[model samples]
Target chain A: MTISRVAIIGLGLIGGSIGLAVREMLPGVATTGWDADAAVRRRAAERGLAGTICETAGDAVREAELVILCVPVGAMNAAAEAIAADLVPGTIVSDVGSSKRRVGEALAKTLPGAVVIPAHPVAGTENSGPDAGFPELFRHRWCIVTPDHTAPPAAVEALTQFWEGLGATVEIMDPAHHDLVLAVTSHIPHLIAYTIVGTASDLEDVTRGEVIKYSAGGFRDFTRIAASNPTMWRDVFLSNRDAVLEVLGRFTEDLSLLQRAIRDGDGETLFDLFERTRAIRRSIIEEGQDDARPDFGRTDH
Target chain B: MTISRVAIIGLGLIGGSIGLAVREMLPGVATTGWDADAAVRRRAAERGLAGTICETAGDAVREAELVILCVPVGAMNAAAEAIAADLVPGTIVSDVGSSKRRVGEALAKTLPGAVVIPAHPVAGTENSGPDAGFPELFRHRWCIVTPDHTAPPAAVEALTQFWEGLGATVEIMDPAHHDLVLAVTSHIPHLIAYTIVGTASDLEDVTRGEVIKYSAGGFRDFTRIAASNPTMWRDVFLSNRDAVLEVLGRFTEDLSLLQRAIRDGDGETLFDLFERTRAIRRSIIEEGQDDARPDFGRTDH
Candidate 1:
């Protein structure tokens, strides 16, 4: 089925980029965008990200067949409520939300009339805003979808193909599994990045500047993660609070042990830890997740 | 005086890179290098990195007017002592060691007849060994010189000019100051990376693979640093114990505060810290340390 009319509820990086990708990859997709920031919506429309900018979520979802909700996790319910009444009976509501379960919970409660699917395209840069969005953001990345057990099979299949067409390898999994995997992989890492960058910011100016300059040694990557959309991460922590806290606890305990070993000058423990992690990096390289080059995905090639 | 004969003692990343850079950038500078691994020395000469492969540090330094010690911190003294008697009188000796005070102290005792200058060029990739060396490693980076007040002025000036000629902006500082600053900037950050990567590696297999796959989220940065020359970093932590421990203390306490804030669900505290860090990243960009593009140095212009 050709998708002509599409609604993007948040005109930020993910939403704007999805719209841009759809426009570029699928020629006739008519994107109608809505944003809390009116200026963002206007700019998105002006930049040809959307065919039209809608005045409200209600207006945005009205008559739209494919509605993409890209707002923060905390705002998903209200956004859902605002659009649910206006969503056409046959509309398929999808989200680019980080937390699938939370979005699924909101949609299950608020949008029973619509075919709701929770999606997370594991692709993005630290940049946010309509201008930062580009059509190629999703190319050569993974897009995971979590469909409710009771949802229509046709809707699930259509959404998978839609993402694949946008240059993503679609993986369907249970919402809980997605959360757990992401908690280890994406969520906990971002939380730690936020924490470390936060810790460094409290230091003296000269030290902090040195941290950034010599960041190539390791700290700069955390800075980039810490620079991510703050509001989005806060909600991620709050919504996925349990899993995040558990992982953070493990990380802290491990760090404490390493700190103690360093203080005691235990070369054995240090070397052991260093040696094992080489395997993890090796595994990533073998699995083709990481490029063999020094930089990740940042192809100097 | 023209640097007609240059001897590089140690054929690791820093030493080999220096040999390669000097060969390409300064065609007139004749170079000979030595490493414990004879095969590595042969490869260096084959790659045009050195004019000749010396059998020993003594052989390398034998009539060279400029002898550079490029061994690890712990090995600096022994390497210096081994070549001390073979050094030509009035020869200018310098080093590419990371810690200044320690290297300076060792060099002062080991090479009493030479004009010894301690220098550190802040350049590298995570990869090490002879093959890991690149000619452009020091280009456009900072190379610091820490000279004793009693040292010959001409020797210090010549060493500074050599680094400058290699495209490194030379900064002269006290040995103690260099140690303190680098501890905050480089050592502490590297220690933290090793700690975190160690944390991730200890996880169960299911979670471990996912960690690598989604490492682009942030953890990959730590992996690179964690993958750095272990023996070199082990020496750094052990040799610079006081500074590393002091910085680690501050970092740990700050990390505890973040842990508390997260447990307390203190959004404001988290927000304040996260926001403050963004400014440091901005400053790093302004300071010409980081690329200011939307996605950091990652986005290709």
Candidate 2:
């Protein structure tokens, strides 16, 4: 069952990018899209994000062999329910949510007997909305597809091929494990970034102007991450609450240890941890997961 | 006094960059540099990090009008002491340490009565050592100069002018205040990054390969920062203990609030803070402290 017709439920960064990518990479595949926001729908249409920009979610999914919900994780249930009545039987229902377990459960609950195969494309920028996407956004990125025992083997294969057509390498994993991995890699990092940026801005001793001036000193990197879509992140934390809180607990514990080391002037302990962390960085670069260029090659220097 | 003969002690990233910048920006000024590490001195000579790569610190500063120490903050005392006997009276001594207050005090104590001015160029990449130096590192970056009351006005002005000549905008700040500001800007950020990366790497449920494979999901940004020179960061935390601990306390408090919000599913609180941080990011871009492009424009996407 090759996916020939696809419907995207939200025309934000992820949905819009999928629409553009499907058109570019799989020319034979037809695409339709809809957005909750009228302005975004108009912009996605103007940008030619899909072959057809449907006015309603139900209309969008009526002929789709695969329907992908790209809304915030918290809105997955509503998005799934909107298209449930129109989705053809055996259509592989999936999503591009950050948290898999919650989204998978939501979709299943909302659309019983649907072939719900939740997936997460671990690719994005600090930008959102229809204007923030491009066809190449998923190129060379990873898209993890999580399928439960209920999903047919053919539908799972079709969803994997569909993501591959959009220029992403696909990995199969359990929904529970996906949630935990993403919590460490995405959710907790975003939470920490948001916290630090807020902390920097509210410091009484350091004015916001001063923080802005010296931000190149490392704070700016966190600011970029913190600038991510607030609605999306708020929903991510809420939906992936258990995993995020678990990893966050470990992070806080580790932080306290480092703080104690600093207080005691324990240079050896600090140096050991700092040095050890560098090996992980090298592994990340070697794996092509990050830019190896100094300062991520952000500036000319 | 115009700095005609400048000496840079400790030929690492900051020192080598200073030498190369001075040679390129102020051709009339001569640069002599010495590093405690023999291999580094050899590398510095091959790269022409300075006009003259001296065999000893005494020789490096003997004929110099301005001396800049670029060693780890913990080594500032020894680096300063190494050149004390050879320094010509009234030579303005400065350093490029991240922590200013301790460095200022260390320089003043080791080279009594000599003009000591401490400055920190808030510029660098994760790479360190002589080979990592680039002439353009300081271009468009801020260099904060902190001179005590004992520093002569003329010497402070000359030091400020020297930094300006290297394509840096110089801001005069109190050493204590500079410590406080940098704690928020650099030290705490590094500490948090190191802690988070360590936490990710040590997770039992998540394989190390899994962490690296999905790092682009925001964990990679922190890894880049955590990969910075470990010795330098260790010294920075130790030297700026008071300020680092104080600001860290504030950050922990902020994290706790956000953690509670996540636990309570308080999306409104998370959304508010996330939205507020975007303004800071915009200001950093507008002020030219960071690249406005998303993800620091690190990847093609």
Candidate 3:
């Protein structure tokens, strides 16, 4: 059950980073990778992203003890189906999807005989594609593994070890809870970023040019998050619909309260909320989740 | 009118930065500064934020040809009134307030004999206070000068020159328009950040510890912005109430569209909005408003 022969089925940022990290961290493990895009496969070869860049999904997973689908959440089921017939009967199947419940279901439904244990490595940059990854991308980051209770314990343990080998600290959680937590932590933040960026772009009185120039005042941070892969993010929201919608509802309600406070010129209400939020940021820095450097140590100026 | 003798009426990040920038860029011009906080004044003196750290606002403005109030928007009037008796009658009075219209009105009403011009340097870091000042904070940044139409041309021109000397590109804008533009670009973004951070913190199902640990996914960026000065932001939201409420209304409307899309599983709508925002980010980087570095070039892994 040790994940030594691994197959990576996406070759984008997450897949490519895993490939590079495995090469650097787990030298004994052999990696075979395939991408739906031929260009990504060629780039993976050029970057030496895997020990072998297989020409087909079946070819990639045929001998792999572990098959990790690294495609967008929407594409997970198709990827699982492609590898199903070729996967070794008891091969440990997993994915690097943002949302766990849907992705776990997709993998299980497609590869019924295989051990479908889904995980999400909560680490990435705004950039994507094969060229946007580096070996240290997952270092000191969280990798939440959401395995179905019916799945074999040995397979889950091996998958956890596999992620830990790549420099991530691993957390085990139920798929539903993972989705709910991430909805607040990742999904809604992105949704808000996309919305505000869109709102700023469509303003009648303010020129997009002006918005761009003054972005550093605060708008640019949202732009960075909003610039993340649209396809992946769109799939995330769609696949994790219930959790996302629930969180979005709460966010909207909270926003309305602030909106009312602003309209009423209630400085105390605004000040109280603003003050409460600061302690969490302090805890994030203390927990080593973010850099304490000012402006995130951006040297863009 | 030439502004050879300048006084800064607050010694926080903006005020301290101005003092340091003036010293670097206009060596011939002397600056005197005073802060309501005694400890901040001590730090300002140690950092040489001004040529002289005066004991009182009156002492700071007594011999100055120009006085810039760098306090929060809520305190602009009081800062103006504090220096009123000591300010030379023809002194060119300005401020670095986020909400220009209210600040402009406050300055005009309080120091009627002085040339009242309000300016907002649309530049900052999340870190504030005296120790956070750096001379290069304003370099390559936009400084919007909002002067009353009836104000003298010579005073406007002199104030423009003063900011330009500190390495900022100056744009003249109407105070009301400046408030609206900043509501979209700065105030609303901050409000959204604060709201999201607060929303995440209050989730009963998700632990605050988990939120802090997994923040690198996207929430950390919001936390950095939400960590900005609560008093400053409280004042901004209060002073720019009408504009902020208007922009917040628009933002909520836009967010609702995306929220509906998520609930309906409409990937296309989400993708379209997400894709549109990337271009604004590119423009911001191209215009030198934000650094083009990845993860804001953070090294604290």
Off by over 4 Å in 1: A1-4, A205-209, A295-301, B293-301
Alpha-carbon lDDT of model 3: 0.91
Where does model 3 sit among the CAPRI classes? high
DockQ of each: 0.46, 0.83, 0.86
Question: Residue B281, candidate 1: how far off, in angstroms?
Answer: 1.8
Clashing pairs in 3: A300-B291
Error of 1 at A119 (Å): 1.5
Q: Which residue segments of model 3 deviate by more than 4 Å?
A: none
What would the per-residue lDDT of candidate 2 be over residues B1-301, giving only the tens digit for each residue? 7889999999888999999998899999999999999999999999999999999999999998999999999998889888988888888888899999878877788898578989999999999999999999999999999998888888888888888999999999999999999999999999999999999999999999999889889999999889999999999999999999999999999999998998898889999999999999888888888887777877734
lDDT per residue, candidate 3, A1-301, as tens digits?
A: 6877999999999999999999999999999999999999999999999999999999999999998899999999888888888888888888999999978887788888898889999999899999988889999999999987898888888998999999999999999999999999999999999899999999999999889888878999999889899999999999999999998888888988988888888899999999999999899999888889889988866
* lDDT values for all models: 0.76, 0.91, 0.91
Of models 1 and 2, which has the larger DockQ? 2
Q: Which stretches of candidate 2 lie over 4 Å from their true place?
A: none
Collision pairs in model 1: none
Tell me model 1's lDDT, rounded to 2 decimals. Answer: 0.76
